[model samples]
Target: MRTTIRLLLKTYRFEFIAITLACLAMAGAELYLTSRLDALALPKECQFDQNISVEQGFATQPEEPVSDPTLVDSCQEKAIAFSDSDQRSAVLMSFGAALPVLAGILIGVAVVGRELETGTASLAWTLSRSRRRWYLTRALLVGAILGGVLLLPSFTANILEHARQPLIDPGSSFNDGGIRGPVLVMLGLLTYSIGVVTGAVVGRQLPAVIITLALALLAILAFENGVSRWESTLAEWQPAASSSYSIDIVLEQDYRDRASGLIVDQGSVFNAAPQVDGGPDGAWIDAHYDSVALVVPGSRYGDVVAVETGAIGAALLVLLGLGLFVVIHRRPD
Candidate 1:
């Protein structure tokens, strides 16, 4: 096993080093950016209070200053600065998130596609008695390495997310679903598996990378859509609290009739409002309707992650199986 690992490392030393360095850099950058964001403390008035009750929606909050009026300018300036820093962090984090996918594609295609493309696979196959064993050894080793390397960036991403929303629990929130935590590792592994299968079938690195990228994108889109639909199914009406500190995934936001417990359409309510003097008046709407939101709460984050990871794992198994079958039967040249 050590010999095989050494050989794999030696053969792809450049790619291995590049991916390792990139991951490390991403981790460092995330930490630095998170710290910068954290340094900007929000004033108590600017900070969201999540203790609001369902009956008194954010819209119904008393129109009185909670903090000294003098602090308003300072709060605005800090808020603006924080917002800018947060945007930068988001952009950097996006790149960091994509690093694993890029690494997986490069590593996976190089592992098998390059060998077959350059006709070295023929020699490797001749030396190995069993093609299945040969393929598994390389695939598993590379996959493990990729997963290990991805952890740093994933961990940093979690930290960054926590910094971004200090009030909300990162584990419970789905704010950056695919980019943080174990899900990122799972996504990396899934992409690697995809590249492996594509490489095995295409037998060419460039084309395999392209196809793998397309497949990965499609998989991501499908997975996100599927998860959203699943979440919608699990969604329940919750009091529409201000989302500044909330971790719920709101699907729909509308007013619910407090008395009848029925959803009221905003447009219809506005249209039906009696006009006083020369303008339509909505003064009575607030008394009859309560703002409610259909949402998947943060508590479901674990369940969603589990289901997503399991699906990806199953797909990885199937891809590995298909790749193995191809490698076992295909002519190395």
Candidate 2:
């Protein structure tokens, strides 16, 4: 193991250094952004106005009209400052999230693909008695390093996420899924697995990196959209509120029959309602149906994260197995 580690460091010193520096920069930026966001105090009016209820959703309204012009001006200034800081933090957070993924791809492909491309794999295979052991030791070592380096940035991203939304629970909110928490580390591992498989198959660094990136993007899109649809299937109906939190993921909106407790088609309700002063009778519709929304609440965030993590873990295992198979069978030419 120590020999393998030394060999890996000697072979990919530049990449290791670059990735480490990038991760450190991401962590620093995230911390800086979080401090900036935290320093900007929320105005009393803004802070007090923001309220959230599971049944009623967010209820944000000023308790009383501002009579003092100076106080009103101060509140507006603070609000604007907070908004600007929040936007900056969000932008940096996104960039920090992508750093680990890119690092994983680079490390994974370069580890084996470069060796194969440069005709060094033949020499390495000649030195090692067992190809399986050789590949596993080097790959696992690199993966562990990548995962360890990624933790710093991932932790900072979590802090920034919470700083940006101090009122909401980051754990329960799915607003930024892969950008923070354990999901980021899992995503990094998944991408590394993708790179290793692609590199093993392609036998070239640059092409493997390209293919790995494309595959990773497609996987991410599929996960995001497909999981959203799946979450909709698991969605439950809740009372539709006039206002909603930015963190909430509402899947569908419709009305429920008050008497039958069944969802009423919105178009059908509008069409069946009697024409009143200008359009459908608002009074009649209100009396017959109550507004409802199909929502995947924050409470289910753990379940959603678990499902996504499991899927990614499964993909990683498959990719790693395939890469190992290729390494064992393929000739180092």
Candidate 3:
């Protein structure tokens, strides 16, 4: 067992080291960027209590000027809803996570691929190693070594928003807790798994790499056309009105269930005053609040996010599983 482990580890040592170094370096860069951002002061609206006038003669005041630091600390953009840094981080991490897929595909093809193309795979299995052990060990080696290297960057990225994110009011994403880190790690492993599984099936390094790349293209198209098109959840918190149609939450499941011609206008929600204070009712909206509050009839925020989230993981699982199964069942001949 020790010999087999050592042999495999030796085979992948360099690749493992490279991945680890890359993860560490990238994570370090992210941390440094985060620190730099923290140092930069941003424009924040100070909501002082307007009630108590401070007389120059008296120190006693009716109300204290309270500062909600969270407001000041958050990153602001034009879009109020999705202006949080976490959402941007999640999107960036999603693309960043895909980077490992390319790396994994190349490495996966290299591990057993070069051996088979060079006629070393058959000889080694026939002379020294059990075929089943070889396949299983290689899979675990690719999975573990690569998975660990990929996991490190994401784990480190979370340190940025360590205690700032509260469940009661999920703050702008500064950490990896929500979707950024996990998505990156997941995409990396899935892509690498595809490459390894591809190699196992093709039994050649370079060809398997090519095949994996081709398959990745198909996955990309399907991911975009099918999963991402649903409900525009990608930019939900981004405060950007990228969607073609306005969203309405009705108790009914489909749009057909709502009143035929009755359009729900959410122009008010966006136009409404952002400040939370003891101002006159609807002071933000500027009038008799004729606009209705956008309601999600039966669904909730969790449901929307979950649907999009599931699409990402589910697509990865489908591709990785099918690729591995085919490779495992193929005959040695």
* Candidate with the greatest lDDT versus the true structure: 1
Write down the RMSD of all candidates, one decimal each.
3.2, 2.9, 10.9
lDDT of each: 0.81, 0.80, 0.50
Q: Could you tally the backbone clashes for each prediction?
A: 0, 0, 10
Put down candidate 1 lDDT per residue, 276-300, tens digits, no spaces: 7765575777777777777788888
Model 2 TM-score is: 0.89
Name model 3 segments beyond 4 Å from true: 41-95, 127-130, 158-179, 224-226, 229-333
lDDT for each residue of candidate 3 in 63-153, tens digit (9 for 90 to 100): 3432565653453331232234445545545545555777677677766566666777667667754565666666666666776777766
Point out the higher-scoring one by TM-score: 2 or 3: 2
Each candidate structure's TM-score, on Cα atoms with residue i matched to residue i, is: 0.88, 0.89, 0.57
Candidate 2 lDDT over residue span 1-333, tens digit each: 677688788888988899899988888988987888788766555653343433344454454667789878887887778778888887887887788779889899987788789998899899989988888888888888888888888888888888777877788777776688777887888889889988988998889999999998888788778777788877788877632454557777788999989898789889989999768898999999988877788778888889988888888778888999999999886
Residue-level lDDT for 240 in candidate 1: 73
Task: Judge candidate 1 at residue 126 and give its lDDT.
Answer: 93
- lDDT, model 1: 0.81
